[model samples]
Target: MIILPQSIAHVQQLIQPGENYYLVGGAVRDALLNKCNNDLDIICPGGTQKIARRLADQTSGAFYILDKERNTSRVIINESNGDRIVFDFTQLRGGSLEADLRERDFTINAMAVNLTDPVHVIDPLKGGRDLLEKWLRPCSGSSFRDDPLRVIRAIRYSVALDLKMESSTIQELKETVVNLDQISKERKRDEFFKILGRGKTSVSVQLLHSFGILPFLGIENLTNFAKVLQRLRVLDSFMSYLGNDSSLLKRDYFQLASFISGLGKQRKNLSNYLAQPNNSYRTRKDLDHLGAFLWDTSHVDECEVFKKLALSNDESTHLYILLKNRNWLHEFVENGGVLDNRIIFQYFKRLGDAGLDLALLTLADTASVVTAELNHDLWLLELEVCGRLIETWFEHPEVVDPKMLLSGTDLLIEFGLTPGPLIGQLLENLREEQAAGEVLTRQEALDWVEEKKLK
Candidate 1:
């Protein structure tokens, strides 16, 4: 009964009459909710892979089998707007469509609709009513026991759809919380990232902590749990302060959420927890910096914690610079040092592209410590100052990079200096002079380098 014109058209083109297939799961729930969800789950009595292949071939999309034993396959249709529509085709889990619905995680997602007759929804469990009521009810009493990962999914769906958990479902979740340990880390990590990806993660974290799931995830200390919550709050507030600015959008806020979630939790190593294979070098660098921020140890470069985390050389260098410069800037701000053009430029130059992220992180950390009653004005002033600096940096990005006037090779060839560490030192001095506006042109830069050599 939903008006998904394009999706319905696609479905009609792919599915013929008499085909034993139905649109199922979240797709149906979202349709009833009047939400446009491109990720559709379809159930078929058989020929799941055939249907997937046909759909992919017809749409010029890509096809892959998600699970061979379960007869599940996927077809991804790339849209003009750069969005992807994923159609997951799977055979019925049990004997019939009704039975398959019974085995679903939540009542709202347990409904189905015939692919041929899209107007009439098949709600075997009155899931449509639960959707109307905005309540999340398990399809069966043993739902959590059926899959402990459903417990996490319940929280995620609750926050995502803005639904409330039924009282009975809440009790069932509490009773079956211990079974989460039986689930694989990969599944748990996937669900956890989904929750973080939705943003507004503090409530979910609090719910997990209250449900005794944090302990299973390695967070046992109550004090550290409070710190984690504080960090999330700070992050939320800082993101709000950024408003419509899109510069921070390129950074993975989901990873930030994940990092904040594990800040207080004890873990074996950062690499094992992240488990993001095939990540770009920038992503790894960002993760390493985030890990260092969470570790919060003195001498981050030499910290045993980082050593055991198994970061790459580039990741380690980025983390070291981020931590060292962040600490310096934080101390400067705490000591009431003036945030003039010179100081801001110095911090930005030292931090490079990570300067803004570090500034936001510093503000969040400061906000986490400031009490409502004491030094509240100081906290507000600090936030304003940081915001201004970030805005100014974005408006005038030349301060950050400052068009390097001289390279190390240039220093060697122009100054007739031998290939040694002193060339690097001279280039560093030249960059500092350029950033400080002492040397504006190439000639001035050469003069400055020559003058430094005389010194």
Candidate 2:
């Protein structure tokens, strides 16, 4: 018995008499797989815009037209459990539901369940059987040709469901791989992030590479592809390590996306490729930062890449700090694996709120290299040390960057010194001294400033 989610059951109650509505796409597929799915998709013959509006009004949800040409619209209902249920309504393509199913990208998504009779599923292309067989099969030969974006979508579903693609579908994918360039970057970006957002990023990426789709994303050479995939796997492990804490999992999407944004290819070419209007990512600022970090090996032209990508000042500064300080972990290991409090404090102070995020990235990078060399014990030790540093940073943040004990106004008033750039320098010096534990009290800071004045 395939049981529908509560949201789907609620939607079934909204189906009016004589209306030919069917629950379609991922909702049906996931239900058969016994997976939790909040997104509901429905297909109706002729038109869907008017019905979608009425459904939104009845459900007290917000509605928006997703694509005007195709008569696709969506209604978002917020559930009390903090999960969002999205109802996507689309007009039947080719004048009938059967035609619509045939036009879909994959067979698993082509199955539909009639809202009027949920028991009898409408499987025109044997998609239900494919779902049971754990195989991803295209509905037709022209599926990829009709929509080249399906190439990436195929890889996404393969990894998401852990299904093997039918031999024919793989052949179709190879034939249609070249047309991927014709697809809009927005579509590609969304699909790319969707793959990354899933926990098994490394698997999805390897699938894409194996299918010869990496070249379209500017990753032409296969030489460094394995290394990049290893890094992504390391990142996935780090995410799992921190998954016990809900707060960390909440931000995993952006962190994972940023980590793999510039995996393969170095030089301005990849940056140029990403900056193109068609290849623009969802979060352009984050992509630009990651791009700058990956390329610009000398770190001299990050600002140049930022300007080309049209990043904001704050975004540029954050990227700069991350890239500039990414090697701190390497330096620490080189210095006999000693945790120098001063160096750790400086890293936390420079990274500020992004301290933990950058630390994760650095740890993942180091672990990737160490694992490649088969040094499991070293990687475990590094993980423990980095975990402790991150915990201490959150627990005693004041130690990372303490409050100013002396102000510039106090310096001028007591020492009769003229206000100038030297005041800013003195303030920074005092902060460094304070962070280093050399100065702890306001009186000590004042005395230190007086001594500097005498010098």
Residues 1-455, candidate 2, lDDT per residue (tens digit)? Answer: 56777787666766778877888888889898888888898887657777778878887888999999988999888778767788998887887888888888889999888887778778899989988888988888888999998999998888777789868888889999999888765566566656763556767878887888766654443446566666666665544433322322333343333333322122132233323332232333234324322422344343454444354566556567666776766566655676655666776766774555465566567555542464555545555556556655655555677789988899899889899999999998888788778889999999999898889
Cα RMSD for candidates in order: 8.1, 8.2
| TM-scores for the candidates | 0.76, 0.76
lDDT per residue, candidate 1, 1-455, as tens digits?
56543664676677666776788888788877787888888888787888788888888899999999888899889878756688988888778889999999999999888867777888989999988988899998898999998988998898777899868889999988898878776566556555541345667778887888765554344445565556565555434323322333333243334333423122222222233332321233234324323535455555543333344565556566666665665666567877765666777766765565565566556555535333554555555566656655656655555678888888878978899899877776676676567788999999988887898
| Candidate 2: 10-residue stretch with minimal lDDT | 262-271
State the lDDT at 218 in candidate 2: 45
Angstrom error of the Cα, residue 183, model 1: value is 1.8
Q: Ten-residue segment with the worst summed lDDT in candidate 1?
A: 264-273
TM-score of 2: 0.76
Q: What lDDT does each candidate get?
A: 0.66, 0.68
